[model samples]
Target: MVLEKVVEILRNYKDEQDLEVTMASTFEELELDSLDTVELVMEIEEAFDTSIEMDGELQTIGDVVTLIEKAIA
Candidate 1:
């Protein structure tokens, strides 16, 4: 459920980039830089109504999903 929403947000963030986004897709592969990642995180937090701590590394969409699950758990 959360992954779907995250993917939706990510796809919007994907902008004009012609890349496929999946749970296994890394931010790097999506061509998202640090600033883009931050913006993405903010959007996710707002969508989920929760704040995510940058206490660990987040590489892929799955990683972000896990973090959000923990936050909203």
Candidate 2:
């Protein structure tokens, strides 16, 4: 469920030049800036009805998935 929503959110920002986003894909690879990351977190929080404190620790898509799982758990 988390992966699906993450992918859906990512698809909105994906460009033709961007690589296909997988669990290993990082924010740098996706060309997401700090502002983009902030917006993404906000969307995730809204979707899950939870708050995620960004401590500059999240890196990969997998990291976000794990965080969401942990948050919702």
Candidate 3:
């Protein structure tokens, strides 16, 4: 459920349909820079109604999902 929502947000944010986004997908692979990452994080926070702090430890979509799950937990 969380992964689907996250992927939906990512696809919408990037305006990409054909690109396959999975847990293994990295932000760099999605062509997201630091500023873009911050904006995406904001979107995720708003969607999840929670807060997330980053110290550049995240690398893959799985990392993000884990972070979100931890934050919400």
Candidate 4:
């Protein structure tokens, strides 16, 4: 369900055909540049009303989803 929500957010910012978030998805494959990545993180935080930790391990959309799920849990 979180992945679906993340997909919706990505769809709003980028072409759906160009990106897809599965459990194994990656940021580079999703075509998110540094700025877009930061924007996404902020948006996710705001949308979920939770703080995602700023860490080096969050290097992909899948990583983000995991982080979000962990934070919310």
Which 10-residue window of candidate 2 scores lowest in summed lDDT?
A: 12-21
All candidates: TM-score: 0.87, 0.85, 0.92, 0.83
Ranking by lDDT: 3, 1, 2, 4
- The model with the greater TM-score, 2 or 4, is 2
Candidate 1 minimal-lDDT segment of 10 residues: 12-21
Global lDDT of each candidate: 0.86, 0.83, 0.88, 0.80
Residue range 1-73, candidate 1, lDDT tens digits: 9998888888778764444678898888888888899899999999999998764498888889989999999
lDDT, candidate 4, equals 0.80
Candidate 2 on 1-73: residue-level lDDT in tens? 8997788877765544344778898899888988998898888788888987689998888988898899999
**Candidate 3 similarity to native, TM-score:** 0.92
Model 3, range 1-73, lDDT digits (tens) per residue?
Answer: 7888899999899898666999999999989998998899889889999988788987888888888999888
Better of 1 and 3 by lDDT: 3
- Using TM-score as the measure, the top candidate is 3
lDDT of 3: 0.88
In candidate 1, stretches whose alpha carbon ends up further than 4 angstroms from where it belongs are 16-19
**Better lDDT candidate (1, 2):** 1
lDDT of 4 by residue, 25-73 (tens): 7777877777888888888888889988766576777888888899889
lDDT (Cα, 0-100) at 61 in candidate 3:
84
